[model samples]
Each structure stands twice: as C-alpha cells, then as structure tokens.
Target: MPTAAGHRAITTASMLTAEGGLELRPRLSEIPAHVGVIMDGNGRWAASRGLPRIEGHRRGLEALRETVRAAIDFGLDYLTVYSFSMENWNRPIEEVTDLMGLLKRFIRNDLKDLHKAGVKVRVIGARDNLKPDIRALLVEAEDMTRANTGLTLIVAFNYGSRQEIAAAARALAEDVLAGRVKASDIDETLLAQRLDTAGLPDPDLIIRTSGEQRLSNFLMWQAAYSEFVFLPMHWPDFDRRAFASALHVFSERERRFGGVTARGQADKVKS
Candidate 1:
C-alpha cells in the first residue's frame, strides 16, 4: 500500500483540528471503471457538532470538490455521486434553497477547474422540479463538458431509482406502441438504453458514506452486482485517504458473476 501522506487527513475518520488544513493525495493510476458514492450524513454531521444543518451541507459541497480531484487522480473512468435526492425536497424550504444556491455557485466557480482537467459534468434527474436558473446552470455545465475525455462525472440531482425505472418503462411502452421496437425485445439491454445512465457502464463499486447500510434508492438496476462499502465517516468528513482505503478494499475482493463461488484462495467451487 502507498503511504497515506496527502490523503490521510481527508479520508480518514479523524476529527477536524483547529486549523482547517486537510491534505488530499493525487489518485493512483489504477482506478475502477465506475465508482458510485452516496453522499449521506451531512445534516447528522452538523447535528453532532452542534451546528446548523445548513453548515454541514455547505461543508459537504466543499468535500465534493475534493472528491473530483480524488477521482481524477485515481484514474477512474466514471464517477457518480448522490448529491440531491427526490426525498431531499422534504427538508425545510430554507435548506433546500440553500442547497440550490450552493449548486449554482459550484457550477459558476468549479466548472472552470473541471473543464481544464478534462472532466465531463452531467446531472441525472428531472429538470422541471429545480429552479429555472439552477436548471440553466446544470445545462451549461453539461454542455461545457460534453466533449471532455477524462473521467465522466455523473451527479445525481433530484434522482431516484424508482422514478428512473418508471421513466424507462414508459419510454419502452411508447416505443412498443409506435411499432418502433418489438415488445418481446424489451430485455435488460433495451431497458438500459432508456435509463439515465444509458451509455455509461454499470457501477463497479458503490460507497455509501455516514455508515448507511441501505441503498437508499440509488442505482438499483445498474448496481445489481456492484461491490458495496459503507463508510462510517459522514459526507463532508470523507476525503482522499478514505477513498484510497475503499480502493484498497476493492482490490482485494474477488468478484463472482454467479458462475463460481470463491472458497479460500484459489478454489472456485461451482455452486
């Protein structure tokens, strides 16, 4: 394992010091093709510190910026993060508005750095629900990174697995009705084509921060067989060393596609 110099303070489950200096290490050359993260525990993290929930959210956004750099350094091909969920709208109006404002600021301020690094930015979710300017900014970011060749960044904004599946089903039904595609041909591949992550590969690793155990309506269909890591650290608390540990864990796992069952070391006994 590489020495955790620049990344330890960021990703480790350590308490923040009086000084807000956190070091982030550059990513290794070997990164997963797809990595999914559920950015949870922001409000809880704030509550623990006896601070307002919005403060935690503000910190979470800063962590997200660090995450982008970690993803790039890791040499990951795709990085998907759970930023806002369909259920997040249930929070207080002030909080929701604050998050939207932060999102806008992120676009205006962060896009330049991302564009320079060749990272593509895309948001997955319904646009009708967000504010007009927020929606516009999202579109602008996507357009700016449409031609980027580095890691593809997917931000799940106002996204839900159930809603995505319903939309895909509706599109397939329409195609079948119009005689464009055969009803019998509506297999996994056909359904995938209609999903928000149509062209992207299925996520290989799904990490849920804040020690959450459930999927929480994340990429249910796409993460059918993804390796899962639930980190105890909150979203804002998660940093580069934490990401490195996750990668290290991922490297040690032996995946089984239902064909062979791993026993000890070299044994792949048929189930």
Candidate 2:
C-alpha cells in the first residue's frame, strides 16, 4: 500500500499531461480537500433485496469502511459523512435501537484501526439527549484519535442543519445579551465560528447517494458554494469507483462562487 506521502508525490507528478497540456481527466492531486456525503437509501437497498432494513444499514457500514480507506489512500484531508440525523428519531423504535447498536459496534470495532492509520475522529451534532453509553462512545472515538494528523473523519450523527444554525444563532444572541458581543458586530464569519463545524473548512464537494437531488437538511449554511454530485446507486453500493466518478464530475465543473469566470467575463465584454 502506498503511504500518504507517496500518494502526494504521485499527485504532484501527474498535474500535467506528457504533451504539457492540462490533464483533463480526474487527477489524484485535484481531489477536493473536503468532501461531504449524504448517505441515503439504505432501507431501499435492503428492500430491493427482500431483506430487513437493518441489513441495508449493516451493509452501508461496510461501504463507509471502504470509503475511509479510499479517502486516506487518495490523500484527502477531510471526509464528513451524515451518519444519523435529528429527524431520524421519528423512525420506529426497533429500527432506531438497531441503528444505535450499529453505531456502538462500528466505534468499538474500527476505532483502533482508524487510530493506527492516523485518522482523527470528530462527531458533530446535538448530544444533549443521547443515551449515556452512546455519548460515551462518541467521546471515546474523538478522544482516542484527537492528535492524529492524517485524514479527519467527521461523522454528522444526530445532526440537522437547521438545528445547528439555530443553536449558533441562539449562542450569539446570548453573548450579545451579556455584552460579550454586540449585535451590530455579528457577521457571517462570527456566526460561523459558533457552528458545530467551526475551524473546519467548508466542504468543496457534496455527494448524495440513492439518486437524491436535495440537501435534506444537511449542511445548509456550509454548502452554499459546494458542488454537488448525486448518484443513482444506494449508499450500500458506494465504493471507491463511485467516489472517483464524483471527483471526476467535480473536476470538470467550473465553480464560479457566484462570480463570473474569465470566459464569461470575456463574453460579457464582447456583448
């Protein structure tokens, strides 16, 4: 297996084609620094196979393991996965209990391997009402890998974009009331600093599996400028190849960030 340093070296060397033209195809060096995934369709995947929904969720966990390996091999800096959402509490009690069990199992089984690989673990989301055991597991995962310098695996479990944003706003309001900050001084940067994702770079690309075409309450504020790639396959079917395909699509896009590109600028002048 290539070390992360070896991957970086390969990416640097392949930035251009032999003819000195721009490399059009996806390059390892061009992979986004941060990628977010909305893991969806686990139930659908299980249903298609005439299996229990929990079975699909189990397979999805395996896919997540594969994704983490690929991210490290590709030299990605951050990979944020939407593991569970605040809305998921509405699920049947048995299904919810199963999901919680899976979470505990994943942490217990994978934490050591992840730590050995120098991956830092960070869990984002509301945790105030979680069961004691589950909360402890989350803390353990983050604490065990806090000092690793390689890929940061951010799990958005029990998270919701609206709730996150609202909490940030409420915190800011409290500060203002206490005179720690003034209402007039708050801005996008100030508000973002209070978010669960503070100190993290905004995701450069967001991928959704299961043919989903919307944000579905994940990262609303942070994804303002992020490019999206929706895949037709279920979350259980996502592999390194599917991941690479998303990167290829992102590489071919012209991200203007709401500003005009050079080509567009020239066209505007001509007009």
Candidate 3:
C-alpha cells in the first residue's frame, strides 16, 4: 500500500512518455495476469435513457465483446466476468428470459470468433438446475474452445461466491466421510482445489463498473488480496479506454501481499 504522495509519484514516473506526453496505457510488465470484472449498471443506464432494460443489457453485451478483444490485446492470461449470478433469477421473468436469450445469442453468434481468436472458454458455477438447452450451450462453448491456448475467458454464469464456497466445503466434507482423506488433510489448498475455479489463478485485479464499490457476491474466496478498480461508467459504456484506465490505476498500487516494503521498513525505523 502506497501513501497518497507515493501513489502520485509512481503515477507520474510510470505514466509519462519519453517526450513528456501522458501515457494512458500501463506497461506490459505492469499488467496483471488475471482480471475479474463485475459488470453493473445496465438497468440504470437503460432507465436514464428511457429505454427498455433489455436494450441496456444488449449494449452491455457489446461492451463485453470489446472487453474480450481488449483483454486479448493486453496479453492478459485470464479474464473472468460475472455474467449472470444465481440471484439474477429473482428478477422479473421477462427480464430473466431476455438475459437467457442474450446468453444463447452470444454463444451462437460469437463462439466461433472466440475460438478463432484462441480464447479458451471456461464456465464456472452450478449447472445442475439450468435449462437443458442452456446447459448444452455452455458445454458447447467450452468444448469448442478447449484446445485454444491464448486467453482464458472465464464466465461466471449463474454464480454466487458464497454458494461456491459452501459447495466446496460440502464436497471436502463428503470426501472426508468417504475415507478419501483425514480431517487433518483438509486445508486451504485442498479446499481451493475443490472450488469451481480450481485450476485458475486468483484474480490480481477486479474491476466493477457503474460506480459500484462492492464485490456483489463475486469471487469472495479468490479476491482475498485483489486490487479493485471501481469505474463510474455503466457496463454499457465500458471500452478500451475505460479498461486501460483501470489498468493504469492498478499500475500505481504497491501490492505488499501482507509483507512490509522497503519504504515501510524505513518509515518504521525512522518513527
């Protein structure tokens, strides 16, 4: 964690071109390997414009397409997005139907392009109760892109972090009961391995749009030390510049990961 003055200094030193121009994009070395996004504000954006909420969601899908391309361009190893949460089922039936339709459309329309771009599709969340068609589409997306080795696009569909954690715990308990392992064998590592995001690295940065500052039940277990960047713009308004700005903000932070930095050590000695 950097002090305010230190943050400003780092920003100034790292975000300047050799010719003294402002560089909005973060350097490649400063980029995080994984990023998770909580896309928000589609409904509010639609309401503000006096349009149907579905219209905003449609625009948000477009934003997601651009974001995937941008993430690939940025050389990010993994990009996770909170697409549809389990709680979203509580919305009006029509709205929920529209969202499901959008998911189908996105896969049917963009899956080929995604596979062609070398993006591996991975879906996380409980799928046992999903509609058969929806489940099949999810399976299709992953199967189509499983061999791609470029960017891994993790879609958190029908996801809730609490439920995910609880499910992991339950699975571990079942394994213990089955004599697969002793109670002492269970630890953070074992528990995390049972999680939906078992093989993926924890997100290094989590970005939320629509001015929201909370995780909203997204990636609670994995976001233990992730840097968050909350943007005021709605999900429909996100683009390359917005993504770049978040990366730039991330670049200025000092992630000590619970350890003391040299500056902190020096300040402690002086004090």
The candidate that wins on lDDT is: 3
Q: Rank the candidates by TM-score, best first.
A: 3, 2, 1
RMSD, one per candidate, in order: 5.9, 6.3, 4.6
- Give Cα-based local distance difference scores for all models: 0.83, 0.88, 0.89
Model 3 residue 226 CA deviation (Å) reads 0.4
TM-score each candidate. 0.87, 0.90, 0.91
lDDT of 3: 0.89
What is the lDDT ranking, best to worst? 3, 2, 1
Model 3 over residues 194-267: C-alpha lDDT tens digits?
99999888888899999989998999999998889999999999987788888878877777778887778899
User: Which stretches of model 3 miss by more than 4 angstroms?
Assistant: 1-23, 269-271
Candidate 2 residue lDDT tens string, 2-61: 111212212222245467754433446546788899999999999999999999999999
Q: Weakest 10 consecutive residues, lDDT, candidate 1?
A: 2-11
Local accuracy of candidate 1 as per-residue lDDT tens digits, 1-271? 2211111212222334357755333345445688899999999999999999989998999888888898887777889999899998999999988988888888999999999999998789888877788888999999999999998999999999999999999999999999999998889999999999998888888998998799998999999878899899999998877887787677656566454433533353433
